[model samples]
Every structure is written in C-alpha cells, then in structure tokens.
Target chain A: MDIPSYQDMLAAHERIRPHIRLTPVLQSDHLNALSGARLFFKCENLQEPGAFKVRGATNAVFSLDRDRAAAGVATHSSGNHALCLSYAAGLRGIPCNVVMPHTAPEAKKDAVRRYGGTITECEPSTSSREETFARVQARTGSEFVHPYNDPRVIAGQGTCAKELIEQTGGLDIVTAPIGGGGMISGTCLTLAKLAPDTQVIAAEPEQADDAYRSFKAGQLIADDAPQTVADGLKVPLKDLTWHFVSNHVSDILTVSEQEIVDAMRLGWKYLRLVIEPSSAVPLAAILKNAERFKDKRVGVIITGGNVDLDRLPWTEGA
Target chain B: MDIPSYQDMLAAHERIRPHIRLTPVLQSDHLNALSGARLFFKCENLQEPGAFKVRGATNAVFSLDRDRAAAGVATHSSGNHALCLSYAAGLRGIPCNVVMPHTAPEAKKDAVRRYGGTITECEPSTSSREETFARVQARTGSEFVHPYNDPRVIAGQGTCAKELIEQTGGLDIVTAPIGGGGMISGTCLTLAKLAPDTQVIAAEPEQADDAYRSFKAGQLIADDAPQTVADGLKVPLKDLTWHFVSNHVSDILTVSEQEIVDAMRLGWKYLRLVIEPSSAVPLAAILKNAERFKDKRVGVIITGGNVDLDRLPWTEGA
Candidate 1:
C-alpha cells in the first residue's frame, strides 16, 4: 500500500464529514495549573462512535469500491476499532466482522454487536488476534481493514488532527496515547504538513511501551500480550504507523500504571470528561514530565470513552 | 427582584460569556431509537464548573456593583450551585462563603474548597440551609445570590436555552430537571420569548417531586428533606421560579429513582457524557413518557456532572 498524500486526508474529511460529529475542544484552568501547561483537549471521546476510530473506519468503509463493498469489512481490534468499523458498516448497510480478545471489555463487545458487527473471540494477544482475523477474513471473503497500519486508515485518522488544528490556535505540541500508534500517526500525518511547526508526541503505558522501546532501539518491536489497565492500548506499533512515528514524532513518553489511573481520575474530576484509561496516558505523561510541557500550548487527544463504567481503573476489584 | 426580561438574559450572556464555556450539544442515535424521538442533549455538564449552574453563578457574581462585589457573594445550594458560585467568585478574585447541606456530595465539597470557597455545613434540609445562610450572610455582609430565584441568576441560566436553540435545528420541546426550578425557569424565560412555539417541560425525581406537585396543584410546595440519588434536585420551587413554571412551563414529569439510575447509566453509555443523576432526570422523564415525545424534536438539558466518581448510582454501595 502507498503512503496517503496530503490530499487523501482532505478527501477523507469531505467523505466522512456528514457521518461524524465535529466534536468540541474542552479545556480546564485547574488542569492547566496542575500541569503548568495551557492544555486543550480534543474530545474525540465525544465522537459519534465514542472514539476517534470512526474517522478511519468510516473513511475506509466508504472508500471501498462497489465490488469490494459487497463483501463487507473485517478487522482485529482491542475494542474501539471494532465497534467503530461496525458502526460505519451499519451506516452503509454492510456486514462487519471483528476478532476481539475474549478479555475485551464487555461494554465494547456489547457496542460492537449493537452496531451489527459479529465478533469472534480469541486469546488476548496480538499474534492470536491476527491468526483469528485471517481465518475470519478467508472464510467470509471480506475486505481486511486493519485497525491501524493501512494508508487508508491512517489518512482517515489524520482528519482528527485537521479538526484539532482548526479548532485551536497555534498549538506547540500535540499528544495522544500510543496504542498501535494510529492516533499519533494521524496527528503526525496532519501536523507534518498542515502545521509544520507543531510537534507530535506519543504517550504510552509503561506496561505496553513497545513503541517507546522501538523508537529508542531504532527498529520496530511487537509485544504479544502486555498487561496494563489501559486495555485498548495493549497492542504494538505496525509498519505504517512506525513510518510516521519514526519520521515525524518528536518524542515518545511512557507513564506508569498508577499514573494512568491517576490521570484518568483527574480527567474525570477536572475535565469532567468520560475518558478511557488509554486516553489518559497523554495527561499522565504531561503531569509526570511537567518540565517538558510547562508553559507550552499543548493539545491532548482524549482517544476514547468506551469504558466499562462498572470497572473503573482506580476501583479495588477493577 | 422582578421577573427577568429577555434583555436581561441577553445582557447576562454577554457578561458571563468570557467566564463560561459555550458547552457543546451531544446526541446519540441509540438514545433516539430507544425513545423514538429526535433528541438533542445540551451538555451543560461540560460547562466550566461541570454544570449549567456556572451560567447563573458567574452572571450573579459579575453583575454585582463594585461595592457589592467587594463584599463578595454567598449562596445556599445542594452542590453545583455552591461549587459554581465559588468558581465564579474565584475568577473575580473575591471571597465566597457558601451554606451547603452536609449531605451534598464529597466531590462538590472538595471542589468548593478547591476554588477557595468557605463552606459552612448545615443540616440536610432546605429550611436548615436557609436558616444557616441567613446568619452567614448577615455576618459576612456578602450579597445573597439565590441559587435560582434571583432575576439575575434566572436571566443568566436563560442563556443556556438560547445557545441550545442556536446550536440545533428547531426544537419542538425543551426539558430540564426542576430542583428549585432554576434551569426550567431559565428555559421558560428564554423560550417563552425567543421560541414561543417551543414547549417547556420540567422533570423531577419522584422522591422529591415538589415541582411536579406544585405545577399540578397550581401552588408552591416545599419539601424540606426529601432524599434521592440526584442530590442536586432535592429542593423545592420558590415564588419567582413558580411564576415562570405557572406561566410558561407546560408540564412536570416525575421519574422513579430506578428510572433516574437507568437513564444515568444510559447517558453514560450512549451519549458518552459524564452526567450526574440530576442531569438524567430529563432523559428518564422522556423515556418513561415516550409517547409524549415521539416524532418530535426534544432538547434535553444535562444539568450537572459533579458526581463522586467512586460512588456511581448503579454500583452496590452507591
């Protein structure tokens, strides 16, 4: 697959404009003071599918050729991507198939089904999901829509940064949690051209820091099954995402599990935003590395809100 | 104090616009499908203080004359109003003294202290609160900004509906939880003049349904210490609020505690909004009286989001 051009992001925006919400940017003076940064939250948590994955999913589902569309779309995701693709396919009246780990949050699985996606459960690991997804795609003869890594998906995800840049003024740095680097890649793909002065930074959970390790080692690294409170961020970076991360991203930061939980609670209290654990990684990083972000105008992407409300990260059992 | 005029609301908007967030509206197709109506959620829960009360609070605080502002402002509230008033006072660099029931959420108390408000605890009853507030107000010589009844406060709250009308296509009906009838009165204040055709409705928790009783009986009734999960809706309508409710509001609907909890969960799930139980009452009312809202465009006000993250209503201990 070829790298998506600047025009691809623009085209994706126009194509998906009618389908998605132009979610609002949220800010808190309390958060700014706590971290000593003027923080702008790109609340994709309020996105139509409750995540930014809809940007890529909708773009891919709609971009499919008429013949290719007939076969429907399929993917393997930790959670948001599956639900998003299903939501997009449901809009186009097409079938969707997803391979999710059996340990995936019940809320996400329920959402996938609610959006008419059929889910196949696999062991909670990257390798297992890929193996399961291959069989499902082969059996169904469906178009394979990777959760990240694809040029089309990356282009679609890039639209979020376009809106973010359009929504805010002169952002010094843009940060997002690095799961498979889909959102960070999108931020890079957009800012590298649209706002060349803006820096792209990726935050990752300490437990799932494959992207950070890869950045330091100067090679791609894949983690099979890293355990972390941020369930949606357990996966590792792919080739497409790595290309952008390696080229455009300024730095990658990792936060401890406790920091992720702390930031999640702070986001809930100060921002009063229903953000998922994975989404808190950026804020956690900012708070832990205060010197790096202090006094800078930073845009933080709240990646998703598809949390199992019954199981908050800070709760005892959870 | 006199009834707030349309010009009062317009002026309040201008005065408080800089201090508040023009919070976004949220919608969910699942919620629309469930209730069989086109629903627009005016997300005041995303307001700067995590509630719509900030609108009235800021207006009241900022509208005070120099002499009055010097002494600062004080109010008696269940939760949001106190925190919001404290927040507004903090912004204006003035002292704020609040009378809050001991039963108000811990989150709210923490927030009030965080914003530099001095909280004096009272018994968990409106009479007890007012009695304590009177002594506190007389001692501090602070301007008393009634949580809802003051014309300035009502006018300020009215701006929410104005924004709602501007943000969405024509709404056939507007609904809000009726505590002291502040928000509902504000809606009436705006829609009565701005969108004369739009019907205003009030929702209440059955455990504290004084507003519903007052609207049905054509007289104000006070419920001193009614208890419900929606802590913010425990108060009764005052004379000024009754004036608007009697003249402009078309109906008052009450929902069971279970319905409020169910709707709160649904709001969290579908809207992906961090809403308090008081915010859910409007949705609960609509869901309970589905046929009343069917085939019509309804604007539901999510009043506040000052909820204790640990004690979600659906959870066992909560």
Candidate 2:
C-alpha cells in the first residue's frame, strides 16, 4: 500500500475546506482539573455529518475525476462513515451506495437515507459485507472508498490534526480514539511532518483492544467480533492505518467500558457538548492514566456525536 | 423597583467581559428548514457554570461595593441560579450563601458546593424559601441578591442579547424562556435601546404559564404551585423583571410539556447541543407557532444547560 505524504494532506485540506466545517476547539476547566492536564478538545462532533469521518469522505468524493464522480462512490460502513459519504455525495450531486449490516440501528439507517445514500443491507460479518459491497460496486460501476484504509481517506483524515495543531498553536501530545485507525493515522500523518515533536497517541476500549495489543506485539493483531459499548471502535486496524500506528504512535492506551461511560457523561455535563461513547475514549484514557499527561497540554479529538439517545450506553440493559 | 438601562448593560458587559465567556452564536441549516425561519442560537450552555445564569451572577458579584463585597452575597434558588452564584463567588473569592429547596436535584446542590458555596436547604415552597433565605442573610450578614429581580442581574442578562445582536448583525426578533423573566427582561432591556425595531418575545411552559397570564392581564399573576418538566421556568416574575417584560415584549407564547421534551430532543439530535428543557422552550414556541416567526431572522437565547443525565425527560417513566 502507498503512503500519503504531507503534501497530499495539504491538498486534501484545500479540496475539502469548502465542503466541511472548521469545528470549534473547546476547553473545560473542570475536566482539566480532574485530569491534571490542560486539554483542548477538537470538537469534530460539530462536523456537518456529525463526525470526523466527513473529512475523509469529502476528500475522497471530491478528489474523483468527473467520469469517476459521475459513476459515484461506494463504501461498506454501518457507522458514521456511511452517513458522511452519503452527505458528501449528496453535496457533490453524485450517487452514494452504502452497504450496511442488516441489524444496524434504525437511526443510522435513517441518517444514510436522509443524506440521499442508497443502502444495501448485508449479513453482519466482514465476509458478507465485502461480498455485498463488491456486488453493489460492480453493478453500479462506482469507485470503492474504503472507510479508513485508503491513501486518499487517510490524507483526508489528516486535515483534522492540521486544524488541531493550528487551533491549539501546537501541543505536547495529541490523542484520538482508534477504531480502524483512520483518525489516528491522519493525526500521525500530520504530526509527523508539521509538528514532529508532538507525541501522537491512540486510545481504544479495553473490550476491543486489538490496536493496543498490536502496538505491544510489534505486529498487526486483528480481533474477531470484539464487544464494546464504544460501538464505533470495534473494528481492527488495516495495513494502511497500521503503517502509521506502528511507526508513529507514541502509545496506545485502553479504557474500560465503565470508564468510557463516565467520560461520556463528564463530556456532556462539564463540557456542555453532545459527544458519543466513541468520542469519549481519549478523555477516558486521560483520566485513567493521568500521570502520563500531568501538566501537559493535550489535544483530544472528539470524533463524533452520533449515538442513539433512546439507548445510551449508560442506560440499563444497553 | 429601579429599571436597568442599556448603559447599565454596557457597563455590566465590560465588568463581566474578563470573567464570563463570549459564547458563540450557532446556526443550524436543518433547524431553519424545519422551522422555516433563520435561527441563531446564542449558546449560553457553554458558559462557565454550563448556563447563562453565570452572566447575571458574575455581574452581580462584581458590581458589589467593597463593604457589601466583603459581606458576600446570598440567594434562594432551586436550579441554575444557585450554582451560578456559587461559581461567581468562587471567581471573586467571596463567600456565597445559597438557600435551595431540600427537594432540588442533588446534582445542582453538588455543583453549588463544588464551586465553594454554602448551601442552606429549605422546604420546597415560596414561604419556606423566603423565611430560610431571610435567616441565612441575617446570620451571614451577606448582601441579598434576588435571582431575577435585581437591576445588576437584569443588566447582566441584557449583555447576552447585546452579544446576540452584535453576533447576528441585528435580528428581527429575539426570544427567551421566561422564568422569573431574568433572560427575557435582559433581552428586552438591550433590544429596546440597541434595536428598538426588533421585537422581543417570551416563551413559557403551558403548565407553568404565569408569565403568559400576566402578559395578557397587564398585571402580575403568580402561580401558587405550578408544575412543569422545565424546572427553571416554575418561578413567578418579580416587579423589576415585570417592568421590562410589560414595556418591551411584543408577545408571550406558551408550549405544552410534550413540546418542551420534543424540542429538547430535537436540539440534542439536530443542533448537537445539550440544552436544558427551559432553554428548549423558545424553540418549542418557534416550532409550534411557525407562522409568527417564519422567514424572519430570529435570535433564540438558550437560557441554560444543567439537566441531569440519568433522569432525562424523554427516558421511559422519567
């Protein structure tokens, strides 16, 4: 797999600038006091499609040539990426075909449809998703845009960190929740060139600690159907994402489900911002391991604000 | 009761500028489409104490003379006012004594204590609250700071509308939920002088419609014990607040309990904001009486965000 350079990230920023919001950077004195760190939250939750996924999706959709753009884009995601790609496709007036799990949340399905994406439901498995996506892509002759692994997508995600660096005037460290490592890879890509002294960290749920395990083992470790309340961080890292993670990440931290829920509640209560469980992973890591971040200025990326309010993770039986 | 002038609001803004945040004005394309009007939400939820109450509290705390300042401040409130007063007192390094109902939410009491205020619990009634507050004031020799009736607080609340007018380049109408009429009076105070052509509106819960009744009757009408899910709006208006509401408000609207919950949910879902039920009242009015605000540039003051997460109104049996 080819690696995207800093120039590509810069170009992606220019391409997607008009299409996405420059989400605000928020601070909480209470959160800072609790964690013993000066934390600046990059609120990607305020993104147009309600997640950082819009950066990469918009970049991919807009980077296409007219012929490919007319053919449209296709992706297999039951999460924010599906909805975000659909949003970008709608913005560009192109067709977006999404392959989602049959058991996906109704809210997620509704969001994709609302964004004008055509959805094809598949069995809830990697094999079924890939098989279904392949058939749909072939039938529609649409370009396949991997959720996080593609070079264009990684370059696009890097724009978030670029904004973070600019917004905070550099930081001692920057952290983002790692799912398939799209956002973390983008952070690594930007920090590696723009602010090499700044440490890049990845946070994940302990229930789905494949990224942490992979970092410690010095090899990519894939998890099979790991369960976690942070539903967005259940996927394992791919080669393109692992390339950045293994090489550039200073550390991979893990937090328990209870910690994630507590952090999510704290973000809502103290920060007064609507953030999802997946977005809470970084703060969970910071609170659980405050010694490492003590007195340091940390930039924590809030990845999204897309959760089923009816079934919050902290609710009984959720 | 002496009425607060625009000059008082200007001075209040200058005094509180260094302490309070200049909250952002957020626009929602989807919300505009839903309501058929351009809405600019002044995000007071992002204020230091997680509500707009901090503006008035800080203004009052800072406005005190040295002798009175040394004596500190006291108030009787069951919601955001108690916590905001505490926050302001903590900022100014002064003692803050609060008399709150014993039945007030534990979270609110904890917040007040967290901000270094002394809480004196009273029975959940106007007579009990007043009797307890009188004793606390006498014992502590603190300056009595009425939650909404004071001129300093009214001036302080007016700063929010001043900021809103400046941020949105002169809105056609301004609206806020009327509790003791603190926020609405402030909106009236500012708009009446700064943009006299702009209409100032007040929203209230139908279950707690004392303000609506008073506006219609052209006289004060206090509810003995009104009930509403919006705990912040249960209080009746005072003479000073009534002065502004009566002289400047163009209309007073009331929404049902279900409408408040629906508006709160819609704000959380679409605007990606964590606003209290009281703050949602203005949006509820806009949604219900669309023709009144349709095609107009409206500034909606989101009064506060201090809701308990575990007991969200939308949750089953909540």
Docking model 1 quality class: medium
Q: Which candidate is the best by TM-score?
A: 1
Expressed as tens digits, the lDDT of each residue in B48-108 for candidate 1 is 7899999999999999888989999999999999999999999999999999998889999
lDDT of 2 at A182: 93
Error of 1 at A7 (Å): 1.4
| DockQ-based class of model 2 | medium
Q: How many backbone clashes does candidate 2 have?
A: 0
State what share of the real interface contacts each candidate retains.
0.60, 0.51
Q: How well does chain B match by TM-score in each candidate? A: 0.98, 0.98
Worst 10 residues of 2 chain B by lDDT: B223-232
Q: Model 2 clash pairs?
A: none
TM-score of candidate 2 on Cα atoms, chains taken together: 0.97
DockQ (CA atoms), all models: 0.74, 0.69
